[model samples]
Target: MNIFAAIADPVRRSLLEQLAREGPTRVVDLTRGRGISRPAVSRHLRVLGDAGLVRAIDHGRERHFELVTDALAEVSNWTATLTAKSASAPQPPVAGHHLDALGLEVRRTVRERGTQPGTRHTAASSTATGEIA
Candidate 1:
């Protein structure tokens, strides 16, 4: 399953949070007061392991699980990519100096909206201003 899908489960996510906070922990230690059986925790761990969110180490008889930092980085990177794309939408630049003017207008609109300037621009405003070069 994908990282998102694996993390969609409250139990699995909780397990991950606990691992992150507590460091490499045993399955038995993870199950304490969770209102779930050891087998159930084991199952969730298995799913997390499959998704590469957790790494399991066999220490003699007991297995210890720890959070895989890189897996969380993937989620962070994916969100950052989407934010970058949406914040600067790929509309083709208007021809010539009009592009600069349009950029200024975009900044103005963003400032008016109380958001970071130039994050968004409107076609109607440019058209009305006869600046659609």
Candidate 2:
């Protein structure tokens, strides 16, 4: 199961929050105030374990479940990469106003002039000037 999918459920997310806040806890303790049966909690835990989000430890007569943060690092790294890419990418110029539209049109014409067939370029045309053609 995907880690995101495992955490997609409210119950599973709540269970993970509990495990993180309280540390390793048994199914009976995790079920407290959750309004869900022990079996349902166990099922959710099983999915969490399968997703590598949590691990179950055998202690004495009970199995204690705890958050496995290493797996969560994958999610954190992916989100960080997305944020970094968005931060570095160039943003479009702010919209509205005829000057902005004119500026865009000027840039578009300049760029397309090179690619368009039969578009003659001279020394005067290549030189940068305040006036737009």
Candidate 3:
């Protein structure tokens, strides 16, 4: 299964989140807040491990699992590129015109609301005996 599909399950997502927050932990510790049995949690961890979402290390007799941040970064970059491409595409005139108009309105509002002349307060001026209040 793809990484997205493997992580779609709420249980798997929770496991990943826990690993992210608590760092490496044994399967038993990981399953403490979960309602599922330890074996079920282990199965979810196996799927995550296969998807490169989690990595396991031997700690004495037990295996500690931790999130593979690099793998998630890969996923993030892929989605970011896809979104950038979609956002940069030239849309139909109606949509493009709407966005252009929105941009202009925002700029106009900012310009209108900007600091007016003589509105600035300066500490040196306030202390100067000859300066206007």
Off by over 4 Å in 3: 91-133
Residue-level lDDT for 28 in candidate 3 = 92
Backbone clashes per model, in order? Answer: 0, 0, 0
Q: Tens digits of per-residue lDDT for model 3 on 1-133?
A: 5789887899999898899999999999987978889999989998998989998999889999999988787679889999999999987867877899988887776577463444554666555635555
Where in model 1 is the C-alpha error above 4 Å? Answer: 89-133
Poorest 10 consecutive residues of model 2 by lDDT? Answer: 124-133
| Cα lDDT, model 3, residue 2 | 78
TM-score winner, 2 or 3? 2
Per-residue CA lDDT of model 2 for 3-112, tens digit only, reads 98999999999999999999999999999998989999999999999999999999999899999989999789989999999999986576458677888887788686
Instruction: Say which prediction, candidate 1 or candidate 3, comes out ahead on TM-score.
Output: 3
Which candidate number would show the highest TM-score if scored against the true structure?
2
Q: If ranked by TM-score, best first, what sequence of candidates would result? A: 2, 3, 1
